[model samples]
Target chain A: MNGLDPGPLLFFVFGWFFALNIKGITDRTYRQASRFVPMIGGSVTLRIMGWIWIFVGGTLLALDFLG
Target chain B: MGAGWGGGGIGYSITLAETQTPDGKTQIGILTSKSVHSAGADFGLSATAGKFYSNADDIGQLEGKGLDKGGSAKFGLGLYGNHQTEVGTTNSKGEGVNVIEYGLGAGLGAEIGGGYSDAKSRWQTEIGSDKK
Candidate 1:
């Protein structure tokens, strides 16, 4: 257990959260970001961010265990 | 909307955002901040340039903040759905302080950051909050 590195797993979960475009996350982000950059406060951008996170997390997981 | 990088404390980021206002308006304008520094005091400025979704032009912004012994400053900017850059720091002992951060994209993504202080170094997620 001591050797566990949680970074990859955490990233994966965050990716899923974003990719899913959960209302709670999108709503909060839109509410806050819309104040400055109104365009970015949409669901599309959030979903993109989520997919990226998932890809990065998956890559990290692969490296951690395979390498 | 944009991308950038710099090393002060040490940080990097990747971002992407919308190009027009939510209502599909083009915007163009300059958003700036009022800088004030004082001991034991905190100050900040925030502004959004562009006409909203009702006008035509591009939109973007810049912002940041810092502290000196007992003072602080913060600023923010956005454009093109909005490109934004922010910075912040604190010097409790009145010694020299260095802090820098850069983010890209019209929306949030990921950032790697860390800083050295008090004879020690530590890693941390980017810091700061959007105005409510």
Candidate 2:
């Protein structure tokens, strides 16, 4: 009826997926990555921040697409 | 501090958050968190997005809430990266192993995250520990 772009919807969905599955992805990346890379990092912090990025980024992207 | 585990560091983050009303409406805004964590351990930080949502059949008044108040709290995933030059211990228990004294530090990695919600709150699931 109005104007709803599928592209923004896709981005929003992608951001949702990333935000939703950040735990698994962060765990795997840090655990295995630490071995070769060798470093000490905060796990929970990473998850929280990653979640923030995906959510914020996704929201703004969706707004941009629609507006 | 001889590399077993050092002191905790304070951290802060800002994220996007939204709220869902009984009428099925949502708005986006900032979510900030502050935390303290060990230099050699894990850290958790979160922000309370908003207050409870009340008053049905008041769409006009709801827009005023606008992330300032009302609705339920929201949660999100987090990831960070830090560049450091110190690793002065062999984390492994066994012998015949080599580590680093000044290698790549953590706190600068990125990942996607999600969470589960209960009756009044949303709980975020943490990742990246003992998965090796």
Candidate 3:
């Protein structure tokens, strides 16, 4: 019930999401010569996941602050 | 933390982790470079601790968890210190370089990590940059 407790949770979640998105992007680019269609799908999927993280993190922080 | 996508000299990493229970505790993370670059890998570790926002009434929280390429580039050992708070995060890192081949350098960085203060401080010295 302390004020700072949520900070770390938020950090961990964001870190996880950030790392995942980066990995997806790097992988798609690396395989560009072999597969072109899959790269598009991969990029879209990564973007969606990145947005999801932002939304979830923002919502949690807002709720925490509001209460 | 940030995610970037590009071509040529690009690097990426992903980690999925979970810990049972809930208690605000410090978590540490380590990163080291690989053979891709002759400058060698860069190693770093960081610690984080805070509370849970999900259950506002709940107390205690716990959690834990870069780049570029080539040319004359640079290489050395470094040390960093960082702190994170609701306001923001501040970090500084320092390292050393040898001018033409090696020397010394240091750097500091600060950013907001999920509303938590984050910072890193480091110092690095070029151990062996003239081996070529």
Candidate 4:
């Protein structure tokens, strides 16, 4: 145990993202804040974000292991 | 694959399975299904991974839903099944087993799945909805 594993934290964030997806806010916020893609419904928009979040988590895990 | 209709259509699935006891021997098989409105059948073959039988079929369904909003929460359930025969290479003996499973997917796509598989029977259930 390395004390406070971020893996669970990442999972919690995924849960949050799920809620945001259902609520359809994350996509709206991203649309207003960035130039990524036009505002789409939560179904399509949030899933894309979820993929990004997974990639970010993987990168963080890799860095943690490397360090 | 399956389809269902009832109370706007929805439910959950949780299947339990036991290991192939006795001979500690295991076999594999193939499955194919087609459903058009929560009702259909599957036909395939199996024979202990060594022999091959022909002409086996069973009933099943195809299930689907789109973003059903129930009291601010969107969710639903789908169920399907199949009848089988001793075709192909599955060597588990005894009558086919029966199972029922329920799942609850919430928030975005927060899907949690758990089920059981045995030597002779099969069942499946899914929980969730798409409202976009």
Candidate 5:
């Protein structure tokens, strides 16, 4: 309540959660598609974006910690 | 790893991504799907590209070469081509085969997202090189 505001903190946490969920879903989707479909690359791009979000969210959380 | 089945069909997809570095440089990647639809089968492909700024030192320093941080967004599109076949009930002693209708389509999309990093690095450099 003093140094860091609760609003940004909550936002960061929510972002992190969303990112993790996306990553998990994408990973599963990719694996399944790759196995059966053979031609469907559903997992690769989505997973890449998922990782990007995870990294960005992690960096934000890290900044909050350092702050 | 996406898997879904709907009778028999074909589809295609294209995706593009752009990211900005902390130093203000932008990177872009493009991916396109060649064959997405097949009868009793599926296929896919993935491609990526990444680039960053590079500056030389000494004499190059006079010319200026360094990484810069900026902002970027990503866009994606999907195209679909399909063909399907089916079998229908035979009438009496006759044989019957149904030819299902199949077609192609194009999908388009765009998204804008960016990030900001801590300004400490720039600030520190500025303060360290202060002429005052």
Candidate 6:
């Protein structure tokens, strides 16, 4: 709790939400968002993206704390 | 193009996209989207009614896919807005989607749009160039 930037924390939370795979939220986001590749399954793509966000957030948080 | 088991469909869209540069320089271009779904099959077409900001793009598309029971034709309207700011560009746009669905085994819809592009272009030009 070094009072570091909270941006990474916010990303972590959003990542968790996406990884949770709430059906309605996933569906609506899939319908509305502009995807880099539209042919992929929305659920699968979102899950992968969520994990990436989690990883990025965690790494940044760790860096903030260590630095 | 896309496919699904229980419900799925394929959709394609084309848009005349407007790209903006910092200090608000803008150019018109094109964007295309092709998608395939494997859940809840349906066929639909969407057209852009209006748009603003960096994305003042007009889009139109026709798509179909679905293997189900009874089929029906449907219509829908959607409004959307997007804004983006980066080092090189900052943009904002408001747009609408008009959809019409026509389903063979499932359901289908279609959309049509017009009359907004000209106004958007003029407005973008004025705001980007700081003209009155």
TM-score of each: 0.36, 0.27, 0.22, 0.22, 0.26, 0.29
Per-residue CA lDDT of candidate 3, range B1-132, in tens? 122222112112111112222243322221111112223223211221112122111111111111222221111112222221212111211211100111111111111111121222111122223445
Candidate 4, B1-132: lDDT as tens digits: 111223223222111222223443222222222212221112100101112222211212111111111111112111222232322322234333232222222112111222111232223322231323
| Candidate 4 runs further than 4 Å off | A1-67, B1-21, B24-91, B107-132
RMSD (Å) of each candidate, 1 decimal: 17.4, 20.7, 18.2, 18.0, 21.9, 16.2
Instruction: For candidate 5, report its TM-score.
Output: 0.26
Residue B117 accuracy (lDDT) in model 6: 12
The candidate that achieves the highest TM-score relative to the unseen native structure: 1
TM-score-better candidate, 2 vs 3: 2
Give the top-scoring candidate (DockQ). 1
Task: Give TM-score values for chain A, per-prediction.
Answer: 0.71, 0.50, 0.46, 0.46, 0.43, 0.68
Best by lDDT: 6
List candidate 2 stretches off by more than 4 Å.
A1-19, B1-132
For candidate 6, the TM-score is 0.29
Model 6 interface CAPRI class: incorrect
Candidate 1 chain B weakest lDDT stretch, 10 residues? B39-48
Q: TM-score of the B chain in model 4?
A: 0.22
Per-residue alpha-carbon lDDT of candidate 1 for residues A1-67, written as tens digits (9 for 90 to 100): 4544454465577667667866577456555655654343355665665676677556646655774
Query: Per-residue CA lDDT of candidate 3, range A5-61, in tens?
Result: 343345446545443656554244324522422222333333444454455445445
lDDT of 5 at A57: 36
Put down candidate 2 lDDT per residue, B5-74, tens digits, no spaces: 1133333333333433344445344332232333322232222122232222222222211111011111
Candidate 2's TM-score reads 0.27
Which residue runs does candidate 5 get wrong by more than 4 Å?
A1-24, A27-41, B1-128
Q: Score the docking of each candidate (DockQ).
A: 0.08, 0.04, 0.02, 0.04, 0.02, 0.02
TM-score of candidate 3 relative to the true fold: 0.22
